[model samples]
Target: MLDLTKLSQQMQGMSQHINREAEASRKRIEIALNLMEQAKLNSDNLMQKHEEFKQRIIFKPATPLEPLNHYPYIVEPPLAHTVFATDGSQIAPSAHEIAYCYLINVGRVILHYGQSRHPILDSVPEIYYRPEDLYLSRQWGIKTEEWMGYRRSVSEAIILAESGQQLLEISPNQQLNIPTLALVDGSLVYWFLEQLPSEARDLILQPILQSWEQLRLANIPLMGYVSASRSSESLSFLRLQACTFEEPNCLKYCPGTGGMSATGTEKKAPCQVCDPLRDTVLWESQLKPGQRSPFWRSNSSILDLYDHHQIYFCYVNVGMEIARLEVPAWVVENSEQLELALGMVIAQVQKGYGYPVVLAEAHNQAVVKGGDRSRFFAMLEQQMIKAGLRNVGISYKEARKRGSIA
Candidate 1:
């Protein structure tokens, strides 16, 4: 870059001045040698690089990543006797406190479909999620715009992880707690479960699995739910997908330390134009993992964009409808972030259809699984008995198609 020339000139001038000053002072001229040595370092490196560039080894660019198996909307199945579809939303802080929201679609409740807003997982903490720990701002002040954006995004994700965990831990003491399947909206679940530095994954999942043991302790069934919406993170992702190539700055890639060894080469050359935001994005992508992806991962992979986890609610041995759900866009980041519901993901859960016979009441339903557990269960049973034969013993096989879980 032209900047290199300026830096070299400045360094040479300083070296020349140092030598002159040493000679005049009649002091240790050896110190001037050290200065000259430092000044010559870049020059020598550049010369070596120039020579290497003349005969640099050629390697074919990587073929595009073949996506893994095509995905099916795999959701969790309701526990035996009752299927519960639940989703959560949180209002988290964002840039300029303008607020970026996210919605969790949990699982689909086919009954009383359309728009519904009852949180089936009642005991969840309903806490806000953030990715940054104070440690981030402490080490790098807010003056660092890049760090600030990272902090905001990460802090929000962390809030998601914690709050999501609470969502799973809802009830612990119900008798017929029977099996239960939980569904969530959006991508990337398990709170970075797949992300770990080997030892770290084991360290994290160990405790997480233990926590889930609570359900086993209570003899209840529980499964995690997840949903994905590419439209949520950035428009650039969509743009990248729609096109085959983008300018280096437009597509996501970092520069080499010397602007040659770093990654991010299109099928041909890169963009010559300079864009501040794009440059910052490249820098951040280099420093962080998974360039251009909305979700988080430790690996520097291109396919991370589309590769998401699918936690099943039922066993392959047991056929059940799996569902994914969605809430409004505005509710996920700003506003209440708690989406009552614009959409509900529907699918069969494993184990069984849950046989939950709940009616659509004000976007609410009571499913009675023929068991005495919590007052919630009692109320549900009453509702079922009151409903008469029309909805009793309804099979999810039938309901899966009908979209009737309520």
Candidate 2:
């Protein structure tokens, strides 16, 4: 039944591709290593130069990013604190299924270290079949699975914020003062919403802003943790510092060729002085266990949509791996809150072997396994039959497989 020879051939081809990619990546990393060595020698000069480029980029909006300083420090968390984490998973609408429906399951976990004897856990499942939820506006011009995924992610984040808000208000008999750190599994900024029309985007933002306000009022620090992040925001800044041409000079010295003769025109400057590598690559070796880099604010246009909740981020070494942590402007402004959050994140990662334990549990709780998904559809079909509704049978191919497998 299996083509072992063909499978072996395919594996050999994939191995070749992996080797090629590895070589290319090595070359790219070498470029970054050279720039970093240069940065150490001229740190003060680069710092002042970065400010000049940042100012000049405002007037000339076409060019890319600004470099920021990388300052690393270690933070020791308080002995007693509570970590509330929430994660979500979803089953998308399928055509072969009888009903046009989608399900989102959110898992929330509360872990109180040095304050409580046991962890608390909960889960909420939401099923959507409303007309508005099933379809998108015609003007949006897309009905792809990616759009549904984005909607699900936004819903998950809102629910997590709400759960965090509720937890902050809880009053227990063991009334010792303990710091609370609320965490979500992804970025705080809804970057995907930038593609939608202003009106549609505003509608989605309304509930998220309300949820954020609840957490803000409760004074709980919320963080979005991304492991093995590929974001190059910091690298983009480094490129600006490494580039030979100043922002203002790009107009004259780096003007396009426009088919002009080389004899009369100024030579085009080299566009990129350093290879495009992720910010983590530079910090992977630099950040020690429990240490974190300084904050770097994103200049993404999507950030403008979030007036007060704009995002700022940093990288931390959690004893096992490097991770990116994103926080809102509110967290960045409060020094005590920021320090507490950083410490807790590091502590959680150390406890969980490079990942947060609460988040891992939340994910396990939320995940919809293959067996569970099959059972869900079977149950739905049975309900439809009981209600005297005609069932749209599953695809013949699926039916055949199900009949033969068992």
On TM-score, the leading prediction is: 2
- For residues 75-137, could you state the per-residue lDDT of candidate 2 as single tens digits? 878888888877878888877667778888888888888865578787788877776777764
Give the poorly placed runs of model 1, Cα more than 4 Å off: 1-80, 84-88, 94-174, 186-208, 224-406
Give lDDT tens digits, candidate 1, residues 56-104.
3121111111111112222333322233433322222333221222212
Best by lDDT: 2
lDDT of each: 0.29, 0.72
Give each model a TM-score.
0.25, 0.83
Worst 10 residues of 1 by lDDT: 59-68
Candidate 1 TM-score, true structure as reference: 0.25
Model 2, which residues run further than 4 Å from truth? Answer: 1-4, 10-27, 37-70, 172-176, 248-271, 404-406
